[model samples]
Target: MISGLGALDALSGPQRFGGATGPLAAAQPSVSASDFSSAVAEAANRTIHTLSQAESVSMTALEGGNVQARDVVDAVMSAEQTLQAAISIRDKIVTAYLEVSRMAI
Candidate 1:
């Protein structure tokens, strides 16, 4: 089974927690239970942000006449697929939590 914090860290990266790295240094975060909630929230937020950006890009391309309509459609579809994956993971987590909760002590 995947650990909660590991999943969250996979989602949030280093920006969610207070951390610093020089311009040349990349942020490296170690996943822990402490970082789980923040990471998952960050992931969900990022997904939404990505979807919004994809929409904006599609719109701009439409207005500027710089790209074919098919490109925009492809971007939107990609964003949708990403969000669906996130949602599916979330549902599985909730189901696992409930199962654990129901276990007899």
Candidate 2:
């Protein structure tokens, strides 16, 4: 259900789009290593939060609470998606690290 651009924005922000306003405009925000690290941390926090929410919902449902089946399904699906995204990012990071390590000094 998520769009490609939405996923990209969620992970890297709007910086990848050049942050331009018009065709002739060329101003872009300066990104530092800390900014990238913060973004990654934020993403991890969000994923953890989502997974926790999904776990709570599932527990509530199992306890015969008032939670609707549809809501539980939605939560599970969202958690699955977040997990998949995190796994994909981890794989990419590992691959990049391995590639960099294999380079000649």
Candidate 3:
């Protein structure tokens, strides 16, 4: 099984929690995005990149190129997980928007 979600962990590098001990640091984030929109945009971009890479790998394998089965499997699985996580996040955001919309002003 794939160990950790690579895309999320790969985000902006220094933003990742360092070391195997695993608890995130209490220090401020290293991501330079100053607002919610930019942060979400960055994540969306990463999602697209991951999906594109997986698709390319699948295409290469379909053409009987030198691609290995293990590499293709890993790419597809990573793309799948990244997509699933993005969808879940989108659902949560939509749900929150709806809930807030119904609240008393």
User: Number of the top candidate by TM-score?
Assistant: 2
Residues 19-90, model 1: lDDT tens digits: 544553354444456667766777677777768867887888968968778888877876787677787888
What TM-score would each prediction reach against the true structure? 0.60, 0.74, 0.70
Candidates in order have lDDT scores of 0.67, 0.73, 0.72
Off-target runs (Cα >4 Å) in candidate 1 are 1-32, 61-65
Q: Each candidate: how many clashes?
A: 0, 0, 0
Candidate 3: tens digits of C-alpha lDDT, residues 34-85: 5456657777888888899999999999999999999999999998988888
lDDT of 2 by residue, 1-105 (tens): 421113335434356434545543335545556766776777787788888999999999999999999999999988889888888888998999999999999
Candidate 3 deviant stretches above 4 angstroms:
1-34
Better of 1 and 2 by TM-score: 2
The local lDDT score (0 to 100) that residue 24 gets in candidate 2 is 39
RMSD list, candidates in order? 9.3, 4.6, 6.5
